[model samples]
Target: MTTTTPTPPAPTPPAPAPPRRGRALDSASSFLRRRPRLRLGLLLSAPMLWLGLAYLGALAALFATAFWHTDSFTGQVVREWTLENFRTLFTDEVYRTITLRTIGIAALVTLIDAVLAFPMAFVMAKFCSPRAQRILVIAVMTPLWASYLVKAYSWRVMLSGNGVIDWLLAPFGLDSPGYGLLATVLTLSYLWLPYMILPIYAGLERLPASLLDAAGDLGARPWRAFRSVVLPLTFPAIVAGSIFTFSLSLGDYISVRIVGGANQMLGNVVYDNIGAANNLPFAATVATVPVVIMLGYLAAVRRTGALDNL
Candidate 1:
């Protein structure tokens, strides 16, 4: 009887409840996994929207503003569309000279940077050990971390009479090429050198050492190998670097103001129109010059397949 009274059967345990968030997450992950294109689109949507709104929107606004004009007496922007700004930009002698000067300086900066950066980048990519390469890269990038104004002002100081450049050249019959077009060119070259180096360095890094070796084995001299094998491959990268240097120089006004002395560039014109002259439409029109130049430059380089590297 006592045995029959049998201990009450243990109550069956209740089944555990499934976690809601975990199920949702797992389902989402599976859904995303099944549609990789959707996943990718989702990932890029935010950035693309930002770029479209911020960059392209601003550019559109600028172009729109360029067509309008300002009232000279009232000093208020007139929303009416007209080609007067374009006419002024195209017809004015001062604007033409400034445009030419801007283009010339940008070209010179691009050239100088290419010449200087190539050898340095070549040495870094082909010759240096990994640790040394890292150190050299740091050295190259250190200047970039400094304030742009600081670097510009530093050059200003060095280019001043009795400053570093003058001091260095005093022993010789030469003198510092003081603040002007020459100074502008030098400062721009220095400032944009890193932009050129980084691209060439990245390009050269991808170049096969085997190709260089093969050229040498086939009786190509060092210079010949470089010209035939290296230069052609690296040319796209040089063009890419030139784009950065050229566009940046084209739009730069601050460095010119700091070290350009009496000289002015297109950027100065835009700056003066916007600030001193209070002419927004004219400034937008002036700003379009560089944008047009860059577009043409990009179109020219597109044939070279340089855009692929970017």
Candidate 2:
């Protein structure tokens, strides 16, 4: 009877179920269960999309302008795509000289800002009380709310040959009037100084007092402690501040034009192309340089996380 029943085949274990045709749905559900990337993507989609479009539009407009040439007869930007204006800029020695002068002057202003801002920031961070720190921060940043154009014009009133310094020095033999690169650089440096100081102060504020204490414990002099510990820690903010000063100087059409005499930067060249020269394409092309440089700098600053302190 056992043989006849074939020993009643041991109960077959049920075969495992195969993955279904709706595999994506199962996968998606599984992803949702594990990762929040989908939620992040949904949240960020709008702003990312908008920013991409805006940058694309700006570049497109600039490139389009670059290709259009200025008509010699009418001084108007004609639709004809050409490189004559850029070529002319390269060939003209006078424009080249002005360009170099602009770069040199801007660099000088940035250097001056760096030299003066570091110690001031270090002092504020390590020494000043929290209340004093708050006041210092306000004092540094308050200048920014003032109109930039007004500030630049204020230099005109001060740096003119008969301005404040000259008036003071008039008591001595120095009666010469001075309104040129020297005056321009000085004014620009003072105007942009606060922008550098605030970032640096903020960086200093974040430094751990423990590090300075360690430096002191190790027999390092106060200056050595600052140089090795404090300065090194705050380097990112210096870079950040320098980047700001550089970019601001780069686009400083208003200040230079107001005070720079015959010295014209790339900004002036671009402005002239659009307004005085009436060549949109050349203006667009010239303007593209600063925008690109600014974007690259902004990206660099973001990577450093220095602006986070601000």
Candidate 3:
């Protein structure tokens, strides 16, 4: 009894008071909770600023430059707004030929990639185990680690006369196209195939196994199940991949220079006008062709649900 009286209940432990900083934090959180729209606006402000200032601003400047004329005698930007650039772009035979060539190659590359990627993506998504799928993905992305120029230069060497293509195909009496439009298509298809494969693979991966089972249970054959269920779901992914491949191929000038031989695409024309001819206005005008084409392509694809899928 004497010992119990001496303890004095340890001074009641100060009632375990809450931290002041924690109270401030709680008040801040409550403030944000009370103003949800303000919170969302604050969150979005940075990215909106970036998009408006950097991306849209650059595009506006580029299109503005397209309207300005270059002084031929002075070799300077005139800053005079005129439609003469568009007139020349549309009226010139060389520009038309190059535009068509660029479009053709881009289309061919996209088609080739789609054909090659489908079976591979289907096998990876539908057939492979999880670990194997991961390994395959790493393998697919591995080549992208190499410098684009390095790969282009490697292809340049391989496609040269008496290079690897020649050495390998000598026994079969076949030959590589050897530095031309065909060579450009081949290199581009190889480079961009992984881009196509990944999207379609993701789309296929998202397909439900139960859906396939249900289709089979309903008396649908493999082909029928694929046609009725799988293809429709995955078509968006194909279009998504095509958008990337097609747009990238449209503006590419380096690969064209390396493997395109004497052939010039729209990109080469733009590059020449800018660097060789010192014509920024005309270059901007030429540049608008691909931009317009891509815009038109996007408009066409918007109805396919692909944009929403992506």
lDDT of 1 by residue, 1-310 (tens): 4668656677666647647768888789889999999999999898988998888999999999999999988999999999999998999898999999999999999999999999999999999998998899889988877888898999999999989999999899789999899999999999999989988998999999999999999999999999999999999999999999999999999999999998999999999999999999999999999999999999999988788776
Best by lDDT: 1
**Per-residue lDDT of candidate 3, residues 1-310 (tens digit):** 5575667755666636668779987778889999999999999999988998889898889999999987778887988889999998888898888888899999999999999999999999989999999999898878977788888888999998889998999899998779998999999898888889988999999998899999999999999998999989899899989998899899999998999889898888889988999898888999988999899989999888778656
Per-residue lDDT tens digits of candidate 2, residues 114-179? Answer: 999988887888789999988888888888889988988888787677788778888897853456
Cα lDDT computed for each candidate against the true fold: 0.93, 0.78, 0.90
Off by more than 4 A, model 2:
1-50, 74-81, 171-177, 295-310
Give me candidate 2's TM-score against the actual structure: 0.78
Candidate 1 collision pairs:
none
Residue 132 of model 3, lDDT score: 99
How many clashing residue pairs appear in each of the predictions shown? 0, 1, 0
In TM-score terms, which candidate is top? 1
RMSD of 2: 14.0
lDDT, residue 117, candidate 1: 99
